[model samples]
Target: MNQAVQYKLKMALTINWFCYIGLLVLFAVWNLFLEGGSIPLWCIQTLPLLLVLPGLMQQRYRSYLWLCFILLLYITTGIVDVMMPTRGWQDGAMLVLSLILFFSAMMSSRWHRLQ
Candidate 1:
């Protein structure tokens, strides 16, 4: 990749990772404080993120591609949550974060392919 595209891709990837982590924290906080969720359940919900962390840190295109697919589940969950009267705000937050992550991942993958 040219320097500019490389820089953009790096920035997008960083943002994507940050947003993903933020979403996890949000979910954990929501489950623990708001929903009285069990610790194991919270961990289980967040564990899939760990699977992608190493690859994301390495800026793997394959990882970015897979993340796009995985993020869809989150998006769907967010939508469902938002549709609920009681959980709308929390789910809205999740939806926004997922959208950001999805955009960044898509950009990173696209730029990597162009490189």
Candidate 2:
């Protein structure tokens, strides 16, 4: 295995949580203008795994399962939110998540390749 790959795999956990925290902030943004205040399943499900993908990819078993649980809820929550996000901030939040997800995934994959 390349040292690069090892290094990248190491960072997966951090990236995952960074994304999740970003999502939480996004939710807070939604709170400002939305009338309904229930979180969707997609947000709940995907939020977690996205948080842990870094460690999971590296085979960090301790929190992999926990991440999966979060991912599950995020996925469901995201779907529901998509259908009906009362808060104005939801859309922006999704856009940000999309960008973050794209960048993180790309960078990590490249890092793995370099290793």
Candidate 3:
């Protein structure tokens, strides 16, 4: 890949990593500590994310594609949570993180192909 493409790919991958890890941490904190949710519920929320970790770590385009699909569920949940009458910052954060993660992951996959 050319220098420009490499730079873009690097940036995309950086953003993807940040948002991906941020969402994972947010989910853990929101479900486990902030919401006092059940362990099973937390696992349910995070298991899919965890399942994709190896592929993501390997920088697989397929993993990024799958992550985008998985993120749709999170984005929908975030939207619903934000619309609740008693919505908290966590809801907004979740929505923002998921959206950012979705786009970044998509771009990462695209950039990977260009590489």
Give me the runs in candidate 2 sitting further than 4 Å from their true place. 32-60, 84-115
> What's the TM-score of every candidate structure?
0.86, 0.47, 0.94
Q: Summarize candidate 1's per-residue lDDT along 1-115 as a digit string, tens digits.
A: 5889888977997898789889889878878987566788778778877778888878788888888888898898888888887775677988999989998998988988887
Q: Per-residue lDDT for 12 in model 3?
A: 85
Number of colliding residue pairs in model 2: 26
Worst 10 residues of 2 by lDDT: 62-71
The candidate scoring highest on TM-score is: 3
Give the winner by lDDT: 3
Model 2 lDDT per residue over 4-115, tens place: 6676666764675577577666665555345654457446534554566577557455444454444444455555666674634565466556455545555555455554
For every candidate in turn, the CA RMSD to the true structure comes to 1.7, 6.3, 1.1
Task: Kindly report which residue stretches of model 3 are placed more than 4 angstroms away from their true locations once superposed.
Answer: none
Higher lDDT: candidate 1 or 3?
A: 3
lDDT per model vs. reference: 0.84, 0.55, 0.89
Ranked by TM-score, the better of candidates 2 and 3 is 3
